[model samples]
Target chain A: MAEIITVEHPEDPRLGDYTSLTDVELRRRREPAEGLFIAEGEKVVRRALAAGYRMRSMLLTPKWVEVMRDLIEAADAPVYQVDPALAEAVTGYHVHRGALASMQRKPLPDAAAVLAGAQRVAVMESVNDHTNIGAIFRSAAALGMDAVLLSPDCADPLYRRSVKVSMGAVFSVPYARLDPWPASLETLRQAGFQVLALTPSAQAEPIDRVAPHRMPRAALLLGAEGDGLSHRALAAADRLVRIPMAHDVDSLNVGAAAAVAFYAVAHGRPGE
Target chain B: MAEIITVEHPEDPRLGDYTSLTDVELRRRREPAEGLFIAEGEKVVRRALAAGYRMRSMLLTPKWVEVMRDLIEAADAPVYQVDPALAEAVTGYHVHRGALASMQRKPLPDAAAVLAGAQRVAVMESVNDHTNIGAIFRSAAALGMDAVLLSPDCADPLYRRSVKVSMGAVFSVPYARLDPWPASLETLRQAGFQVLALTPSAQAEPIDRVAPHRMPRAALLLGAEGDGLSHRALAAADRLVRIPMAHDVDSLNVGAAAAVAFYAVAHGRPGE
Candidate 1:
C-alpha cells in the first residue's frame, strides 16, 4: 500500500519529477538521466504498471485519487494528492486527465539481444520526433513487427508526449538502440536478417514486389521524415524498397510510411 | 498583377480572412460559410494555386515577399505584407511559415462525380479530426487511392491545419461529401466497387487473405479513431476486412490504418 501525502506548494521538492513538465528540453535530458519516465493519464499509468515498470511515484488531483484507487493500493510508491490548480502550477499544463505516474526506466537491452529472437524488426534512423517515434511504435506493435531497433539519434520513446501518443505502446514493444549506426547495422546481417532500407527513391524496388513477409528474417529500415535514410545507412542495407506511390504525391509522412512498410514486411507472415 | 498592400494593424479588414486561425470552431464555420480556405506555408500555397484554387488574398512576412516574388507577380489577388508579430496577432499563433493564403473553395464535386472515373476510392465515416483527415489524404494520394468520399460529418480537408499537415495533398486528391451516409454508400456498389469496411473485429477476414489488391474496383471504408464504423456503416459494406495485428494490440491509429488499407486496396492495380 502507498502513503498519501497532500502537496500544496508548486516548488515542493517531493514534486520535483513533475515540475517543468512542459519544458521539453529540460525534461528530455532530466528524465533519461534520472532514469524515470512519466506516464500521464489513467490509461498510460495503468499500462506502465501492467508492463512491469516500477512506479517511482504518482501525482493525482483529488478526483483522480479515487479513480486510481486500485493502482494506489497495488503500488509500493508514494501518492501525492494535489489540487487541480496546484497540479497545473507544478506541471506547467492543465492536468486534463488528472493522473500521472513517474515510472523507472529499465536499461535498454542490447541490439543483439533484442534481435536474437526476432524475425521481423524495424530499424529507425534519426527519427527524433517524439510523436513520430510513438506513432511508429504503435504501428509496429499493431502490424506485427517482432521488435524495433533505433539509431542512436532517435528520440526517447518514453518521453511523456511519446507515451501518450502511443497510448503506452512504448511499453508493449521491446526496442533497443543501435550505436555506431550504419556500421552497427551489420549486427542484424550477422544475425541472418536481410536488412531492407525503405526509401522514396525511384531506384528502389517496390516493397510489395520484394515480398518481405515471405522472408524468414527481415529488418526494415526507415529514416527521418524529410531527409530520409542517410547515404551510409542506405548503403548498409541489403536492398532498397519503396511503397508504390501514385498521382505524383511526394511521400507519406514518416508515421504513415512506417505503418505501410510494417504491414507489408511483417504482417501475415507464413506460419504465424 | 497582384496589388501589394502594407498592413500595419492586425485587425485590418483585409486580414479578417486569416484571423483566429487557432479557433477551430470559428474557422470551421466561417471558412466554409465564406467559401474560402487557408493554405499555409510556401509549398502548400503553391500547391493550392497549382490545383486551381483561386487565391482570395495572401499574407506574407517581409522576408517571404522576395522569396514569393513570382507568385506575387502572377496572382491577381491582393498580397498583404505583415510583420511576424502582426501575423501572430491575427492568427493566434506564431506564423513560423511566414506565409498564408486564403483560397476560394470551389463547390465540392458531388459523390457520383468524384466516383465516375475512379477504380479505387476511400470512404471515410465521421473522421472529424483535421490532422487525421490530412494524414489520410496524404496517404491516399501517395498510395494510389483514386479519390476520397467523406461522410457528411467529416472535417473539411481544406482547413488550414489539414492543408499544412497534408503538404497540400488535399488539393491534389479530389474528394466529395456523401450526404445521407450509409445510404449514399450504395452509390459505390452501383458503380461496381466492392466496398470493404476496415475494422479490428474478430469477425473480419485478415485483409491480406482477402487480397483487396486483386479486386478490380474496390472502395475501402474507414471510420474515426475511437469508435470505428457505425453499425449501419459496417452493415452497408460488402465485406469487413482487417489488417492482421500482433502482440494483442487493440488497433492502429486511423491515419496508420488508412495508409495500410489504401496500399492494400489501391497500390499497383492491374493495368495501371
Candidate 2:
C-alpha cells in the first residue's frame, strides 16, 4: 500500500510540480523533473498507474480519496489528501474531477523497437497541436494500430491536455519520436514496412486502393494542417495515398484524418 | 460598393455588435441584433458574404481594406476602416487577422427545407461543444454531406468559435434545429430517409455495411461525447450503426466519428 500524506499548505514544496500551470507556455518549457506531466481524473490516473509509469504522487480531495479507494490502493506511489479548496488553489483551476497524478515520463522507445512486430503504424510529422496528438493516440489505440511514430516537432503526448483529451489512451499506445526525420524513415523501409504518405496531391492513390492485405507492415505518414509533409518526408515515403474528398472542399483536420486512415487500414486486416 | 465609415471612438454605438467577446457565455446569450455573429479572416468573411447572411457591417484595418479589396468591393454593407489598435480596442481582443464581419442573424431554414433534395445528412442530438459542432460542419462539407439537422440542445453553429473552427464551412453547410425531440426525427423517415443513430452499442451494425450505395437517403445521427445519443433519439432511428473499434476502447470523439461515418456513407456515391 502507498503512503497517505495530508497536505495543509498550498505552497508545499512537494506540490511544486503543480505550480505555474496557467502559464502553459512557460510550464511546457520547464525542465521535466520540475515541470512534471500530470494526468487528471480517476480514469487517466488509473491508466498512468497501469502503464508502468513511475508515479511521483497523487493529490486528491478527501471525498475523492474515499470514493476512489480501490484505485488509490492499486498505486505504488504516495497519496496526498488535500481539501478541495487547497487542491483548487494549488492547481490554479477548478479541478472538479478531484484527482490528479504526476508521473515521470519514461524514456522513449526506439523506432525500430516500436515497429519490430507491428503490422500497422502511424508516422506523424509536425503535428504540433496537443489535442490533435491526443485524439490521434485515442484513435490509434481503438483502431488496432500497433504503434505510433512521431517526428521531433510533434507535441508531447503526455502533456496534461493530451492526456485528458486522449482519455488516458496515450498511456496505452506505444510511441517514440524519430531523431532524424526523413532519414530515420529509412529504418521502417529497411524492416520491410511500406511507408505511405497521406497527402492532398492528386497524384496520390485513393486510400482504399492500397488495402491492408497488400502491405502487412505499413507506416501511414501524416503532416501538419496548413502545410503538409516536408519535401524530404514526401520523398522518403514509398507511396502516396489520399482520402478522396468532395470537389471544392479542402481537407479534414489532421486528427480526424488519422482516425479515418487507421480505420481504413485496420478494417482491411482481420486478426493481425 | 460598400460605404467606408471611419470611427474614432471605441465606445461608439456602431461597434456594439463587436464588443465583449471574451465572455463566451454572455456573448452566446446576446440577442441576435445586439450580438451579431462575427466572421473573422478573409476566407470566412468571403464565405459569409456569399451565403447571403445579410452583412450588417465590417471592420478592417487599412491593410485588410487593400488586401481584401475584391471581397469588400463586392459587399453592399458599410465597411469601417480602423487602425489596428482601434479595431482591437473595439473588438476586445488582438484583431491579428485585421478583418472581421458582422452579419444579421437570418431565421433558420425549416428542417424540411434543409432536408429537401438532400441525399446525405447528419442529425445531431445534444452535441453542445461548439468546436465539435464546427468540426462536424467542416467534415460535412468535405464529405459531401448535404445538410446538418440539430436537436434543440445543440450549440449555435454561428457562434464565433464554431465559425472559426469550421474554417467557415458552417456558412456553406445548411442546418436547422429539430424541435419536439425524437418526434422530429420521423420527418426524415417520412421523406424515405434511413435514420441511423451512431452508437457503440454491441447490437449496432458496422457503419461500412450500411454504406451510402445501400441506402438512397441516409441520415447519420451523432450525440454528445460523454453520453451518446439519448435513448429517445436512439429509439427514433431506423437503425443503429457503429464505427468498428478495437479492444477496450469505448468510442471516438463525435466530430472524428462524424468524419469517418460521412466518408463511409458518401464514398463512391454518384454526384456526391
Candidate 3:
C-alpha cells in the first residue's frame, strides 16, 4: 500500500521531480538524467501504470486522492496530497486533470535488439518535434509496425507533451536510438531489411509502386517537417519513395505523412 | 499600385481586425461577425490571396515588406507598416512570422455545390478541434480528396491556428457546412455519393473493403476525436467503415484517421 503524506510546501525537496513542468529545456535535461518521467492527468497515469512503468512517487490534490485511491494503494510508493494552489505552484500550471506521477524510466533497448524481430520499422532522422514524435508512434503502434529507430537528434518520446498527444502509445511501441547517424542504415541493411527513404522528390518512386509490405523485411526512413530527408540520409537508403499526391500540394506534414506511410507499409503484409 | 502607410500607434482603429489575435474566443466571435479571418505569416497570406480571397488589409514588420513587395503591389489593399514591438503590443504576442493578413472570408458555397463536382469528399461531424480540422484539410488536399463538408458544430476552418497548421492547404481545398446535422447527409446521397461513416465499432467494415475509390461518387464521414460519430449520424451513413488497426488499439485521433482514411479512399481511384 502507498504511504499517504500531506505536503503543504511548494518547495518540498521530495516533490522536486514535479516542479517547473512547463520548462521544456529544464525537464528535457532533468528527467532523463534523473531516470524519471512525469505522467500527468488521470488517464495518462493509469495508462503508464498499465504499461508496467513503476511509480517513483505521485502528487495529488485532495480531490484526486480518492480518484486515485486504487492507484495509490497499488503503487506502494509515496503519495503526497497537496492543496490545489500548492499543486499549481509546484507544476507551474493548473493540475486540472488530477494526479501527476513521476515514473521510473526503463533503460532503452539496443537498436540491434529492437531491429532483430522487426519486419516493418520506421527510422526517423532529426524529427525533434515532440508532438510529431508522439503522433508517429501512435500510428506506428496502431498500424502493426514492429519497432522504431530514432536518430540521436530526435526528440524524447517520453516528453510530457509527447506522452499526452500519443494517448500513452509512447509506452507501448518499443523504440531505440541509432547513433552514428546515417551509418546506422548499414545496421538495418545488414539485418536483411530493405531500407527505403520517404521523400517528395520527383525522382522517387510512388509508395504504392514500391510495395514495401511485399518485402520480407522493410524499414522506412523519415525526416523533419520542413527540410525532409538530408542528402546523406537519402544516400544511405536502398530506395526512395513518394506518396502519390494529387494536384501540386508540396507535401504532407511529417505526422500526417507518417500515418499514411505506416498504413501503406503495413496494409499489404502477408497473412490475414 | 498598393498604398503603404506607417502606423506606430498600437491603438490605431485600422488595426482593429488584427488586435488580440491570441484571444481565441474573442477572435472566434469577432472574425466571423466582422466578415474577416486572420492569416498569419507570409506563406499562408500568399496562399489566401492565391486562392482568390480578397485581402482587406495587411500588417507587416519592416523585414517582410520587401519579401511580400510583389504581392502588395498586386493586391491594391491597405498595407500597414509596424515595427516588431508595436506589432507585439497590438497582437498580444510576438509577431515572429513577420506578417498577418486580414482576409475577406468568401461566402461558403452550398453543401450541394461542393458535393456536386466532388468524386472523393470528406464530411466531418462535430470535429471541433481546430488543429484536427486543419490537419484533415491538409491530408484531404494532398491525397486528392476533392472537397470537404463540415457539420454545424465543427470548428471554423479559417481560424488562425488552423490556417497555420494546414500550411495554407485550407485555401486549396473547397469546403462547406452541412447544417441540420444528420439530415443534411441526405444531400450527399442525393448527389450520388456512397456516404461511409468512419467509426471504431468492431461491427464497422474495414475501410479497404469499402473501396470508396471504385464508387462513382463517395464522401467519407468522420467524427470528433474520442466520442466518435453520433448515433443518428451513424444511422444515416450508407455504410459504416473503419481503418483496421492492430495491437488492440481502440481508435486513432481524427486527424491521423482522416489522413489514413483519405489515402485509403483516394488510393485506387481512376487515373495515374
Assess candidate 2 and give its lDDT.
0.85
Q: For candidate 1, lDDT tens digit of each residue in B69-182?
A: 999999999999999999999999999989999999999889889999898999999999999999999998888888999999999999988887888889988899998988
Per-model RMSD to reference? 1.9, 3.0, 2.0
If scored against the real structure, what TM-score would every candidate get?
0.97, 0.92, 0.96
Candidate 2, residues B176-261: lDDT per residue as tens digits? 99898879898898888999999989899887666653688999999898899999889888899988888787588887788888
Of candidate 2 chain A, the 10-residue stretch with the lowest lDDT total is A263-272
Error of 1 at B212 (Å): 1.5
Model 3, B195: alpha-carbon shift in Å?
Answer: 0.6
The residue-by-residue lDDT of candidate 2 on A1-272, one tens digit each, is 77789999999988877776567787677735454688888888877878888888888888898877886677777899899888888888888899888888888889989888988999999999888889999888887888999999998888888889888889888898898877999889888899999998999988877774357788999998889899999998999998888788768888778888887777642222
Could you report the DockQ of all the candidates, in the order they appear? 0.63, 0.45, 0.56
Query: What's the lDDT for candidate 1?
Result: 0.91
Which candidate, 2 or 3, has the higher lDDT?
3
- List runs of model 3 lying over 4 Å from the truth: A269-272, B269-272
Q: Across residues A7-108, which tens digit of lDDT does each residue of candidate 1 receive?
A: 999999999999989999999999999999999999999999999999999999999989999988988999999999999999999999999998999999
| CAPRI-style grade of the A/B interface in model 2 | acceptable
Chain B TM-scores of the candidates:
0.97, 0.93, 0.97
Which residue pairs collide in model 1, if any? none
Pairs in clash, predicted candidate 3: none
Candidate 1 regions exceeding 4 Å error are A268-272, B268-272
TM-score of 1: 0.97
